[model samples]
Target chain A: MSETAKSSALRGAAKSARVHVMRSQLGRVRGLGAAHGGTHHWWAERLTGIALVPLSLWFIYAALHLSGEPRSYVVRWAGNPINAALLAALVLATFHHAQLGLQAVVDDYIHHKRTRLVVLLLIRGAAALLALIALFAVLKLAISG
Target chain B: MKDIRDALMVGRTSDGRLVHRPLSPHLQVYRPQITSVLSILHRATGIALSVGTLLLVWWLAAAATGDAAYAGVSAFMRSPIGVLLLLGWTASLWYHFCAGLRHLGWDAGFGLDLPQVHRSGRAVVIAAAVLTLLTWIVGLAVM
Candidate 1:
């Protein structure tokens, strides 16, 4: 290869490598790829979603068993330790998953940044509050039963 | 609000001309597909399930309060409207459950091909119906 051409080629390769490094550094600085906190949210949704599978099925079975039964029967059912634990797990996971999914929908459809933020906060807050109430009910019955 | 609306209105040039913007394609622009229908249903069912959870809260609260309170809630549940709501809740629960399985499958890198996607979508509907029926039948029979 000609000396000038070889030197220029080496210089070009070095410059390109530097550019690649800088680009990655810039990406890191941007922090979590635009959405800021998507991975954990997504993972939590998926995990809770999966956990809901058997829990939901169990809930359905248990609920159906209580169908047409007396109030005392239903209350007694809830008081069972195993039943209460399962119910609590299902309620928590289902609400958490719902919140995550709703957050995703709001984020995608609500183009107005301020509105999106407000909606997300409202959803999260409501989900947490409802979940707490549900869990407390389950615990109260389970304990006193 | 008026100023915001004015700012949002497409664009205006100093020469007093307004620039036209191209309209984006929306739901009408695309042909309906199973995946799309199921996707929308997933969201709808999710919302329904959230509402249905209130019933759970009510039942628990009633039971905790007293026998009379529980009877009031239980009576309403035995009414025709209550039965219908229960049926709806059951369907919503199973539908969401099955569709959720489909989602989990996709997340795990399975049934993502076009044909498989359609098959799973159909499966979700069928499974939900069958499940709802089975639960109700067994429930009523034993009751």
Candidate 2:
């Protein structure tokens, strides 16, 4: 078989691999497209969530002790190398989880394709910005301490 | 239900005519039950926690910025409204945590039977409440 024929055959196999039903054709229906990387998204969300289980519990315990404490106290808390490291981990996991969860919410709630796309991008940007700002704060406090 | 019913999803036919799909029953149509309530609560608290991150970041930024900046945030946090927000966040955090664990269990093919599901749902609610109350109690005593 010619190279083109072989490649076309491979392409045909890939398209057929997709789950389809009778009276269905590609792009024939709206609101039926696969998320493509859905499993990855679900798995990553769970992984980050598992990491957060310990990180968040520890944070809550530490934060309770620091309640109504001064800014210097907070600085000292974050200044501890272990605290700083764990706190950094917490921030990253938090924003990542938040972004993924919020993205799912947006995907479900926003009916308009363009609106959903724009909102998702905005969420991605906001989560990154917040996470970076937090990490920066932790770094500054750790260094100053 | 009212707002959600707006903008029924439209499908395109082979010949390019628009066809709207039938709407799924909305929130108001459901009879309230523990399982359903907890499911909605899980998502609600997750979204709430996401919003709470803004305040967390704000406090951290204020502290890093300087004493004056931190003092400003401190004042707000001590205010009645700020205190309420903090309490709400703490509760939301705990609730989301418990519900999330329950979710993980279900994903792993556990506690999925009808009775087990209901049992776990109640457990999550109670656990979240106890945790939140304990945190605030400890927080005040330590403070």
Listed per model in order, the count of residue pairs whose N, CA or C atoms clash below 3 Å is: 0, 0
Chain B of candidate 2 versus the native chain B: what TM-score?
0.82
* Chain A: TM-score in each model: 0.77, 0.75
Task: Name the best candidate (by DockQ).
Answer: 2
Name the fnat for model 2: 0.84
Residue B65 error, candidate 2, Å = 1.2
Q: How many backbone clashes can be found in candidate 2?
A: 0
Worst 10 residues of 1 chain A by lDDT: A26-35
Q: Which stretches of model 1 miss by more than 4 angstroms?
A: A1-36, B1-24
Q: Write the per-residue lDDT of candidate 2 for residues B1-143, one digit (tens) a residue.
A: 35655566667776999887777777899899998888788889889999999998998899899889998988988899988998999999999999999999989989989999989988999999999999988887886
Interface RMSD of 1: 1.7
lDDT of 1 by residue, A1-145 (tens): 9999999999999999887764465566765643456779889989998898899878878877887677778778887889989988988998898898888778768888788889889988988988888788788788884
Task: Kindly report which residue pairs in candidate 1 clash with one another.
Answer: none
Candidate 1 lDDT, tens digit per residue, B7-63? 455766658899754445557989988889899999998888877877887887777
